[model samples]
Target: MARRGKKPKGRPVNGWVILDKPKGMGSTDAVAKIKWLYFAQKAGHAGTLDPLASGMLPIALGDATKTVPFVMDGRKVYRFSVRWGAETTTDDTEGPVTQTSEERPSRAAIEALLPDYTGEITQVPPAFSAIKIDGERAYDLAREGETVEIAARTVEVLRLEIVDQPDAETTVFEAECGKGTYVRAIARDLGRDLGCYGHVVELRRTSVGAFTEDDLVPLEALMEAAEEGRERLDAEAVEAGAKARVVDFAPLDDYVVAPETALAELYEVMLTDEQAARVLSGNPVILRGRDAPVFCEEAFATGHGRMIALGAIEEGAFKPKRVFGGRG
Candidate 1:
């Protein structure tokens, strides 16, 4: 017999859902769809993909939302196509073409130009972007026909390799970039640097953090599964054929990088069980680890009062920052 317990509704499912976002749907729309499907009380996405782009989008359900920032901070890889001789207002096919040229650079020219952008560089974001300027979104300002002058921010381009040169008019490339790097902006900048107008004709995120396209589930499959009584579906079966599918609870740790991974660069300060309990109760503890310089600070609980990990030392031992595994 099926185990009798609380129904799935409002019963938060911990960990992340790697969604293979479909094109033409907004990222938030996808999150809302998943939230409704899972009947989860809290849900958030680690990163946003443009409506024109598609691929892995990590959706954090329940307490996992607290760790979304860590996932977002991880590097991203993308496979994209940039069409030469055309510039768009939004740096993508969805936007209006503002300018065009007859000249198309050869693959050799494009490859040679890549070196100029292959390392740490400053990139000016597209005006029709989510970047905020003076308390307003740059896209909002651009929509209002207002001038939006955004400062160029430095971003690392770990790699930019030409995967395919279909023709002199278009170049297919793959890039691995740090957080806040924009592929659309890369398209725009590459065009400008090469003395030709360009915009991304196709873009697909291959990976975000440790999640990848191979781990995503199609939204349609998810919707169908939800309609077919999601609770009855085995977690393993749900993930069997999809890039993103429901994972078994036992392997939840595989999908979620423990919060401690965020503090890998920091010094370790293990605590006694009593010290951990005290930290859970909102008390600062002193750190006495000999591996690093001695310091003192308070470690406090983080995210929905779940004490699962310890915080950095300030005036105390690393205290319980998050707690997990209890009746919700």
Candidate 2:
């Protein structure tokens, strides 16, 4: 019989890749491609961007995967164009049009209605969404000809405004919102209120957490960089007579940001080597110095510039909630 518990392959590459995912590619596929390029043992993404949407998709490798929740919880910014006079089943261009109207909302009408969508408001997720229905995905059920009714949930929209009026048929909008705010839903709701049906014709996520356009590395650029890096590695291996398939990963390091980038919103506490050691072993350590925080709901500790743990500070002690790599 073949061994069942074989060790996983790939290098233990750790960090984030702020990928500018192109349209027509899903977030999972983007992460998988990145993982393959880096030859990472484990990989995940901070948030899911629909296959129909493009732009920033933060791919996390190895230890960086641990910080994904923090990034997911952070605010997201999206710029999208909505096609007036049409509503789609998926609330995006990928879906078939379910309703249409000849009427179109004027640019002034959209601007005036923006406030109603901003702040905390309730909205229903699209039928073709990742939301679960009776333990099955809503999209899966919807695809199987089953009706999916997602409950109305409150979402925080920090800002929603008309950015451009491309034509009478389309209007561009930019929104900054908390987790679970769907851009598609925003477009759909706006169209309904304006007496015209609408759906997202073009959607792009510009920012998530600390990740922004500045941090974006286009998919093609990454592939090109990987090709060069892999070629160099292969040549070095041949010249040195090293064992084949060795992944140095140093050449591609320049493209990856540190894992701590996801925790930018959290307080950082620099620890002594001894304290770091204790934290890695899942122990709490007393923080000293006059400037030390007496209490923090969430904080990350680093020693020698390496992440040690993410935890809370309570009564002058930092408690390790999630420990990272062994003490460096």
Candidate 3:
């Protein structure tokens, strides 16, 4: 007789895991590995990466999972190589060759076309993506040989620069873009604009939101460090050890920047502790200084008494966008 019953599992803790995703592993796979490694209560990644791509993949564990949407809205930067004269079904290296051309443009020609994509532009996501259509995954529909119509989305290309233009068959470039911009689509659209077919051969995300590759820890190294009792350490030690690892694996407090920090670039504001509490409680509080930027956004918890973030005043009152302290 075999026993088939539920086993005992402990509750999962809340935290963030910045994974230095390796090529050939999908984002979901990475999350599963981390979840298993930590026995996390819950885990999720801020964004998805194709199996063929690599780079920073932020994994939110525990309560951090609740913040995934906010983190996903942050901008991203990538370095990728585009191969000209060829197109693929998935728009990347893993896809089967759908089309190819004999003509390849020169470096100058490719550089000239870069400007066309430098600013805000409309882009269509690849059909072989996670996008949903009629409540079904687009990739699922695409795999079944069904043609799916994906609407074009507007994305901002903050920066687009050619890093290397080796001949004309391949071009290595770097791009910084806002959320929802698909690099594969950029390659595809660039090919269309340049009068040639193109597909992404290699893609590496350098930054996402306020996080960069410099802040990621390789899966192998992270596993080793965890085994060495790194995970049981404090925030200061984590920050110190991160320098040696050549990655920023510091705790959530280090990288989970406040929304007010981003807003600081827009305006500045200051608020009293009492006013901050009111704002955090969902009630707007009036500020004295109107001309000067007011910082009223407080992420601190009412119970814990530790301050997290201070937000700016928009109209006449203080609005707390993110509170970090207390139970969270």
Tell me, by lDDT, which candidate is best: 2
lDDT of 2 by residue, 1-328 (tens): 8768778798877889999999999888888888988888999998899998989999999889889999999999999999999999899988898999999888888888988899999999999888888899899999999888899999999999888897899998899999998989999999999999999988999999988899999988876676655434477677888644424556567889999988988999899888888899898999999899899999999986788788999999999888887632
Candidate 3 shows a clash count of: 12
Which candidate order results from sorting by lDDT in descending order? Answer: 2, 1, 3
- Supply candidate 1's per-residue lDDT for 245: 38
Tell me, by TM-score, which candidate is best. 2
Span of 10 residues, lowest total lDDT, candidate 3: 297-306
Computed on alpha carbons, the lDDT of every model, listed in order, comes to 0.73, 0.89, 0.72
C-alpha TM-scores of all predictions: 0.76, 0.92, 0.74
lDDT of 3 by residue, 262-316 (tens): 2222334445687655655656566575364344333222222333333445565
After superposing candidate 2 on the true structure, give the runs of residues whose Cα lies further than 4 Å from its correct spot.
1-7, 232-248
Candidate 1 per-residue lDDT over residues 77-146, each given as its tens digit: 9999999999999998877999888878878788897887878989988898888888898988999999
